[model samples]
Target: MPSVNAPGLKRRKNRDGTERLYWAAPKSALAAGFPNRIVRLHFSAHDPAQHPLIEAACKRLEAEALEWTAGRRETRSAFDGTIASLVRQYQTDMASPYREVKWNTQRTYDQVLGVIEKAFGKRSLAALGISDFRRWYDEAKKPKAPGGSERVRKAHGIISMMRRMFAYGVTAELQECGRLLTILEKARFKQPGRRRQKLESHHVEAFIAKALDAGRQSLALGTALQFETTMRQRDVIGEWEPIPVAESAGGIVLGARRWVRGLTWADISDAFVVMKVTTKTGSEVAHDLTLCPLVMDLLARVPADRRIGPLIVDETAGRPYAEHAYAREWRLVARAAGIPDSVWNMDARAGGISEADDAGADLDAIRSAAGHSQASTTVRYVRGTIGKSRKVAELRKAHRNKS
Candidate 1:
């Protein structure tokens, strides 16, 4: 029998003549030479399970030692040096592209990255498993904003980018590293309820009346023209132009055109208002709008000062308002007008489609006015009118019976 000699150690002989041993070294030995914990076993050559059991036990012991060693090493080299270096390189190289995104979008990415870095800063990217990623993703999905699902989707995008960076690092320098990174599957956050309220025509009229009464005729008319033209606020203020009074039958004619990089406005014959507009769908086509009397009168009242390159100027930047700046101002205007929190500026486009349909406008006309590629795209806007149509049909049937 081979006897155990270490202190605080035990050994027992099994019926098959194999031995199992457990030992605890002195605390001083941990710092001197030996680790605080150790295990050993010996078996006769005839034991069938001995080899497999010993192999598994050896692996477990090696893994524990590796974990302890990782803790004692320098923070930068704790993750085998390669992962740490890759993170530093990615942070350095991402500055320019990150800056090009909108400020709000950049902020969101920054916040998500901060959370992920804080959680796994000391861990090796190659060592990351799917379980760790699930934990992080679940934490990120807790915040419920109006577009919470979209926000969480963007967070997942950031994670995907990080994973790609690590993969690139592995291929470039860690060729000998055999471990595969486990990435979390893409997950979508739950969508919040739609709280959007459609602005009625009467509400639009009231807003116009208030603006005109306040001597802010230009702002009033601009807002009205935006609703009538179904132009986004960015397109409306960025592309305002004056119309010519020539050949005026009843009202002056004005035209605005959106160029490739900029916008232009000109006055043509009173019979036609022509402008080259780049629609949101990326089609560069000329739009011929018939100038209404109200639109012409509104154009005449626009002050000379507001008649810079575009109708709206960024007072802070002293240039044509960028989309972000205009969107901010539009939000303030909507709030001041007592617009419901649920309603957004896009509702105006919906309202315009509804108005055109009520006036018996052709589907093609509605599609052109709304700048949609297909008339089917405009069909969604009139879906609410199905109820009205049913009621009208019932009334017509009753009237026919009485006749």
Candidate 2:
């Protein structure tokens, strides 16, 4: 909030043609706890008109900064403690190496940030107490999800992130911030059930056919690739490209470059090929590309020049397709096919494994295909949602087939 042109400011021009602004707080001012730092001005020193503006900024900083620094850091008022401001301050440290976050985790944080801003962005952090959090939890309704357990979870995450931010504020030596988390104890969270979005093999065939018929060749192929390889959407979403073939010490190297987690076009070019896929749990599975006729056929429909590019791409725009576009395309196809539009393209992978279960594939085989570190996790995917009888029938079919 303090400007570079504040009192006692000095300017320097560097060989790189950019200007720098530096101010030394009088030692007496520093003793009073003024935040002393250098400010690098992005403007060129050659600009003569900026001098007066710079001097005025320094004077204002000199005058206004003393009030904040003259005493101990004071508690921020509620109106001043806007969630947006809190998030900005928190993110300054989060971007620091000591607090770096993963890409996927950062995406979740961004989503939560929007929810917080919508609910209480303008509210002061210090003014909020137990009562306010309770009220937010009871009233939190996501724009798209109005009245479901999912809505409750979204509210829970928003409050949790607020609590996390306050914890960071406390770590930054702001007083009374950590105590505010106690207010969130009344916020209830939903215990989510096992996910049940899956498809049978026949259903997958129908979905792909309809998707292709709808003129979304890339979407159709991408969905089939997920099912055929049982890959997580991240790994399957246009990541696969052609790699140069060559002989290596151990065997054939699949590509000119290697990705520990990425697949190549060559990996799926044949009836069965060895390729490794990694999942969210940080484990990798080698897929022997079999049962992939549908995926291969869809690939053949793509233009030849684009074949070496991503498996799924926005060919009209000459770029990769957005994740939401994949789901939106699937919804269009589903609606046209008379299937539930609630089905997600992500469910195609689950369909592959569940179909494997129905077709009497070994649990370990399914587990390996799905790239789960723990086989028990794969077992959970096969759990029947509605009734035990459904699972019983599948087991009975496997038994009958063996006889």
Candidate 3:
């Protein structure tokens, strides 16, 4: 048997007159028990000269493996048993799951992680108890927004991540350790009141007028287009080049790659207009919207120059506005327009649908325009009767008299 000078490699002779290679962690690495530094290797019984490339490649691989093993061992040993080391490991291993989530979602998790690290930094994971979690939760729940409900949603999001991490630890390395289920149960969030407050047509009109009057033409166009389209804030203001008017059928069409998920530009012909979108629920449907004179006029007002790339861009950055930034600006615009700050900006889309229905648009037509998978979803956006209730009542009365 030959022992290689490479710190982690050991060669052993097999009973069948063959040789095998194994990665033996350094004595310090074995003592520390960090999985990353552990490596193992096996080689087939072949004459080394017959596969000169394979022999050379194996030597190169072994050298690189030894380098990685030593580096990780040294790094882990420096941190010893500190919280910082555990967090670095956890973040490295667990970070991928959060990557594809929306920017707003990632921001929420980051904020939550910060609070958790601040409160529990010195404590060992096994020692975190129900009372410690409760103290954090109680402190988190005290601040209220203007509508007066506690703004502890951020805290709850953090606790949820901690719970997931603890669960992963239990499954991956700590089965014998006591679980944090009891602590997590106490910290779970209760459902707050319905958060989606619909804005009125008057409010929408006022917002546009104020933005336009303030010489904020781009903002006015962005606000109006988003309201009319019912697109997600990100989709509405993303780095998508709008379908050219010559190509579009007198209606706004977005490149399928820009708005729709799970489909590529190559999947459909460039000539195909995007009439439907697949939502997160896996339903494929098109948004229904009327090319109302008002909507047409709003689109017409957008300068051809500003329409060069994305329909909406951040006024300051000249880049696509992230959803949260758009939401914040939406609130500011609503407040400036004399609308209640409590009103949810998302309601503007619903308000537009309702207004169209009031003007005698068909239910099915509205559904198609809004890209709702079900007509019922479109109905939810219909805030009030839209005079349909009165018209139905009048028809019922006339039918009763005729009978």
Specify the highest-TM-score model's number. 2
TM-score of each: 0.48, 0.61, 0.57
Clashing pairs in 2: 5-57, 5-58, 6-58, 7-58, 78-124
lDDT of 2 by residue, 115-136 (tens): 7877688786556777777777
Pairs of residues clashing in candidate 1: 243-254
Q: After superposition, how far is residue 314 of candidate 1 from its true place, in Å?
A: 6.7
Query: How well does candidate 2 score on lDDT at residue 83?
Result: 67
Q: Best candidate per lDDT, number?
A: 2
Worst 10 residues of 2 by lDDT: 251-260
Whichever of 2 and 3 has more lDDT, that candidate is 2
In TM-score terms, candidate 3 sits at 0.57
Judge candidate 2 at residue 137 and give its lDDT.
65
- Comparing 1 and 3 on TM-score, the stronger one: 3
Per-residue lDDT of 30-144 in model 1, one digit per residue for the tens?
Answer: 5543342544333332465554544444454445445554554323221233344445544444333553554445566667566556656567544555566666666655557
Name the regions of candidate 2 deviating beyond 4 angstroms.
1-85, 94-99, 102-108, 121-129, 142-150, 166-174, 181-187, 191-194, 239-263, 266-271, 274-282, 296-307, 358-365, 374-380, 383-403
Q: Write the per-residue lDDT of candidate 3 for residues 45-88, one digit (tens) a residue.
A: 35443344334434544454455556643333222222444444
After aligning candidate 3 to the native by TM-score, how far in Å is the CA of 202 from where it should be?
1.7
* Candidate order by decreasing lDDT: 2, 3, 1
Q: Rank the candidates by TM-score, best first.
A: 2, 3, 1
